[model samples]
Target: MEKGLLYPVTNAYREDQKLDGLWDFKFDPASEGEQNGWAKGLADPIEMPVPASFNDFFTDKDAREYTGDFWYLKKVFIPQHFAGKKVELRFGAATHRAVVYVNGQKIRSHEGGFLPFTADVTAAVNLGEENIIAVKINNELHRDALPAGDTVTLKNGKRMVKPFFDFYNYSGLNRSVHLLAIPQGNIYDYSTSYEVSDDQATVHYQVAADSDADIKVSLADEDGVVVAAATGQKGELVVKNPTLWQVRDAYLYTIRIQLVKNDKVLDEYADKIGLRTIEIKGHQILVNHKPIYLKGFGRHEDSIYAGRAFDLNVERRDVNLLKWIGANSFRSSHYPYDEQVYKLADREGILITDEVPAVGFKMAAASFLGGLDQSFFDGDWIDELYKKHIDQVKDMIKRDKNHPSVLAWSLCNEPDTSTESAVPYFTKLFNDSADLDPQKRPRTFTLNEDDTFETSKCLKFPDFYLLNRYPGWYHKWGYEISDGEAGLRAELDEWQNSDIDKPIVFSEYGADTEPGLHKLPSIMWSEEYQIELLEMFNRVFDDYDFIRGEQPWNLADFQTVEGNMRVNGNKKGIFTRDRQPKAAAFYLRKRWNSLPLDY
Candidate 1:
């Protein structure tokens, strides 16, 4: 049975919780178990925390990097009072691939690092006794893993690699781990689809369950007023809207589903669904029949304290800063984010573009193509990588499709260099998404620039065209005369005049700046430089009509190997790394909200 309730896992670094402790670890070079016979036999034991990487157990020299199979073991006990309860083992995240074992019995295995997966361990756990949990993880860097290509050193002594992107890849249980107790028959998965007409609105509720139980479903407004209710033998219900939800109106309704067995409410789940219509026509993005511009930024799911580990306070801080800056949207850059982000976006009225982690080039492909070198495409790994990426996309859409804030399903980020190979993969993903839910259309891949041959080639595959243009930041235009405003206008005009005939989104555009660092106007990552750049872009935005939206390079200062030594990434956030607001914060908020800034 699929366990559907979302539960919080312990943050990976709680010293007092005993969830972050040392564990017995061994690496296996062969496909078969040979290192310590741990995978086959479970006599010798070591201890590890629920939310830790194998590197935690290794010494300095041995832990620097990991690139093979590593096994982890830990003994946990379920209290006698907790016995006879339905217990499930949930993993917040694990890198590459992982197989889980409980008491030496294989329970489940999963692939991917940014999403959550679970296994029902009630049957495998010995009731009221100590149970051993083992996890085997495999990490292999391959090309065709997404963005294809290699490494380079810019003139400023800054380095750029094929992960051609930013952010460190911290392998292991980087998210969270939790043990949940629930009733025997419970709600598995719940999703809602909304449709609106002139008079009445219809919402379809689909639910999955573990047993044939009676389910009660209800729809209520912002206030606790029920507008609809129904009981079903199977897990399906329908509701008619009393008041629909829209961005301008920002009205949301809650759909609550409760499982009833033997005259008792066993488990309950509720989804916050908004009623709205989104359409793309010409070069405008319309929500509920009104044109709206997406003044936003691209985001990475990394924190200074937790890295990629789950931290609710950090997530709240990120969303709060976005609202404070007057930005209305964000792109989950390069990868899908925690599910909670989507819910917050819905509640806060922020538009979002959810993306998958189909990034980087493999080593072999980089050598063969002489382009950017990324590990995602190495060694004839296209089919496997594509399948894995597709699975991640499916999981993302299925889990978060009902969110009103999700504007589009971004297939990939700046996968320009490998257009030919990436197009088919994106097409399949788009088609599959359409089949699953017809409410949202698949937005094809995004390109870094408009003139690249790859961009023109892949234009036909997507429903809309999104270009990531940073002319003032990257082009060879003279620094003496800033092209910040002119560059944006020129790129928008070029795309508007192009024969692609698809709506254009300024997918990425922004400059980086240290929050309080003052420097010369020409230098990047300084408050002065970032403000100048943003002001120019904001002016162009005021005059342009062809562009539908603009999502700046980033929302907050994120950690990047290249960013550390040389501010290589556009540190162009309205807030600092610790979420302190910068001077540009007020400027962006004013522009996005159509308010005039005195500065």
Candidate 2:
């Protein structure tokens, strides 16, 4: 495959096209012999693509849900012209744990299911000939794994432990696989720090890699002219007075770092780093010393087709929609999103709040009423959970930290009924945030409509206090036509007078209604009601100086198999599952863009 092409893995039997079918297969149980023995058998194995699950390929329905050890193999012949070149095997993403083997040699092993991993296998392959590559995937359910435990319960009362979230978890090599050719000791990772002041700008650059490599680093202007260059220890380099990147004026500059060894250029990588300062003072988020109100929505990485597979076209479509509606920011809600989304946001000049997928609690009706057990939050398992959570967060930051669009790193979303213990969690997260990027913005969490809860009130002095209030959607009297506006107004007034004196954000506030399912003029789920509710909130938001932003309940409708009244899961999205816009979308677009009155 080419360097940057995106391929998706899907169920081979389904109508959805899949690329995983082209792979070879095997099954290696924990009781099996050494991993090397399996690696040796890769030359002649059952051929299948990485896009399929064992259940998808087998006739037995019972095996469809089986989670255990499985081996996948594929063979590719290297071109003679690419001989002696540094070849890296890159897996866009995999689930749980994966170990890669090349021609009977274990090359690399990676943990964490969401982030990308690569292994340099140039020495293990024979150029100009067929090479056998095998990958071992272990999908066993472990309580220590992130998003652990059974999320969905079956009608037969059988509970299955899976990576449960609001959307479907389509496991396997669900992303892309590629073989990239580069020189040795190339750019492994790079960090860019911009110090912008009134008169001048300075940029600190750090690059990491293998020993004593001659690295050439330079910053280029918008017109592609070199502005600065420096050579330093190991692979570190710095460039000062680089052109600063700002919002609105958004002056962007590219830093090109080339790795050379023995007078031959090995690898070259370029990054677009933005130089600007962000500060929050007196309920205002200032970028480059100017107050900017954020109008945005929370988004989940789910498509009608591909499940969690990353699609560049789909990401671009979502960003275009946000831009069309005059949105300047996005919240990667519930979990961390694909790196491509963050890159697009930086290029398009949108503010972002990247979140870690620490969304706890069982969402069943019985579980909701009974509430999450406090014991679940306490134990030795809690430490492992926090470690896994922090690992995921660090991986996300490492991959997307250079992008200026990211404004804050949200620790977690509505961590189950916040208690005094929650304070320590946030405190630890705050310390971690400082360790990762001290110059970046602070971290925060959201407090939904449970003000009476001590945990909610105690989180007042946090970096930012976000409220997810949907007065007309969840209140007892919300269904009544006469009480809708009055109830919302009263709630807003009460919240404004609360003891918390920090930057406020309406993190979530939208009603779920099936698209094209129009109701009479008086119903809460009606098209008229959705638009009216948003307008009422917008008016109230305009009057409040403390509320710095408002992200509607969701950007698009996502999957929830647990059937609800309106539709499957929450239907409260401006767009449908297939990404069709609702009638209320136009009103929001007009209001956000400050377009002429046309309602």
Whole-model Cα lDDT of every candidate shown, in order: 0.64, 0.65
Tens digits of per-residue lDDT, candidate 2, 147-255, equal 5544344686433334334443445675667676654554666776656666666667777655466777877777888777776532322345545555433566777
Backbone clash numbers for all candidates listed: 29, 11
lDDT of 1: 0.64
lDDT (C-alpha) at residue 530 in model 1:
69
**How much does candidate 1 score in TM-score?**
0.82
